[model samples]
Target: MASVRVEALTKRFGDRQVVNKVSFQVADGAFAVMLGPSGSGKTTLLRCIAGLELPDSGSVYIGDVLMDELSPRERDLSMVFQNYSLFPHMSVKANLAFPLVVRHRPRGEVEERVRRTAELLRIEQHLDKRPNQLSGGEQQRVSLGRAIIREPRAFLMDEPLSGLDAPLKLQMRAELKRVQRETKLTTIYVTHDQVEGMGLASVLGVMNEGELIQYDAPAEVYARPRNAFVAGFVGNPPASLLEAEVREENGNLELRGDGFTYRVGEDLARALKGNTDRVIIGVKPEGVKLVRAQRAPNDIDGVLDYTEDFGSTVIAHLRIGQGSISASIPPQEGIGLEAGARVGVRWDAEKLSFFDARSSERIV
Candidate 1:
């Protein structure tokens, strides 16, 4: 396994730039995932690193070798594409051995490597089966095996789990994590799925409009997003944003929204003291508490819209005044909240996030 690095990478087509000055490093044996929406240049950036598409500028480094001047073959990186891309006529064993065979390794060596890879990926029983004979999950394992047998410097996977069903995807995700941990291979994964990225990647690079918006640990990115875009994009159910006014009352700061007023924490209040009256108040679903009735300060009256049950937890959608908000409630809490039920929502002052209205950037 080896580290991978990209510096000042830029890719352009015609007058449109697909990637703009993208730069990040994948530490040795680390799983780094690049995530973004469609047309956001995530795949293009991966292709650039794999040498499938050369960049117009910037350099890529795999270990100590500079890859910008080298061909894909010379870069010695294995890539598993979105589609299985397995040779239909070849058996799983043959497909796994193809990499070593093409490199002119001895037959005994190829057989040993292929056997080991298939076993590691738990596809030993399907070695003789052709691609068409295997299930989608099995074929994905075979593709991963082919990449693994190469024993390249690093593995590049582009949305490898996109085609599998939910259960199969979950199974394969766990398997992939185990394989990566056991082999300790440097891996770069490209995906638009935030769940997949957050579950597997040790480090995540969030891209938007051809540039990386944030590069950090998954928890860090979710908890302390640098700006509104990162905050809005990284969380599940996403963070809630409300248009509110910040004001000082009796020498204490408070955030006034349509139907409620919340006292800001001392630290947060200090950060927004000199800011304009209008600011965006952001909070995660978990931060908002849905109570059966009204509470003290920081509470807002609303009518429950609907409940989304996801097994262990329920997300309550509430209409507070002219705006709507969602809160995650524990299953056993059993507020029995339903559509059109009157309710109140409250959150801790420290849980609030303050962002500038004009720039949409976090205050602190």
Candidate 2:
């Protein structure tokens, strides 16, 4: 296993800069995921690392070796693509053994490695099946087995689980996690799915518009985002952002919007003191509570717009003035609420996040 590092990596297609001055490091034996939306330069960045596409500027290194001049085959890294990239005419065993055969390993060693890889991926039963005969999930296992048999310096995966159904994707993710743990291979995975990125990564790298937004542990990225984009993108249902003005009322700072006013604590006030009057307040869906009875000092009254039931928990969409915000609540607690129902939304001042409206950067 080896560490992978990219420094000031920039790639351009025609006049468009798809990857602009990107830099990050994946520790040896750690699973790192680069996550972003489509056309956000994630796959382009991965291809640059794999030597399939050359970067316009900067460098890629594996372990202590600079790999800028190396060919894809000479890079000692295995790339598992989204399509499974299996040989249509070859059986699972043949597919797994192809890498070793190309490297001109002894016949006995190739057979042994193929068998071990098939067993590890739980595809030993399907070793004789061709790609056409295998299910989507099974074919993906063969793809993974091929990569594993190479015993490459590192692994680069580009949305390897994108083709599977939801349940199958979940199962495959668990299997992939187990394999990575046992092999301890340095892995850089590219995907647009937040759930996949958050679930698989030991280190998470968030990307947007050809820039590296944040690089950190999944929990830290979700809890303490560096900017409004990271705060909005990393969460399920996303964090709700409301436009407000910072006003010093008596001794306390208050955020005043069209239909609501939220008082701020000293810590948050101190953080926002230097900012302009215009600011954005961010609150996660879980932080927004639906209060049925008496309104508190921080409560904001709104009309319940709609509800989405997800068995154990429910998402309540509320309309506060002209803006909309969502609240994640337990079904039991939100059972009495209905569309057009008058409701009060309240959250702790400590849970609120303050951001500069113009820059969209976090102030608190």
> Cα lDDT of all candidates, in order?
0.86, 0.90
Top candidate, metric TM-score: 2
Worst 10 residues of 1 by lDDT: 331-340
TM-score of 1: 0.95
Q: List TM-score per model, in order.
A: 0.95, 0.97
* Tens digits of lDDT, candidate 2, 1-364: 8999999999999999999999999999999999999999999999999999999999999997999999999999999999888999988888999989988999999988988898899999998889999889999999999997879999999999999999999999999999999999999999999989999999999999999989999998888888888877887787888999999999889989988888887777888886779888888898888888887878898999999999988999999988888889999987878789998898856566778999988888
In Å, residue 29's CA in model 2 sits off its true spot by 0.5
lDDT of 1 by residue, 66-172 (tens): 89888888888989888989999888888999988888999989988887898899999998899999899999999999898978899999999999999999999
Candidate 2 off by > 4 Å: none
Q: List ranges where model 1 is wrong by over 4 Å.
A: none
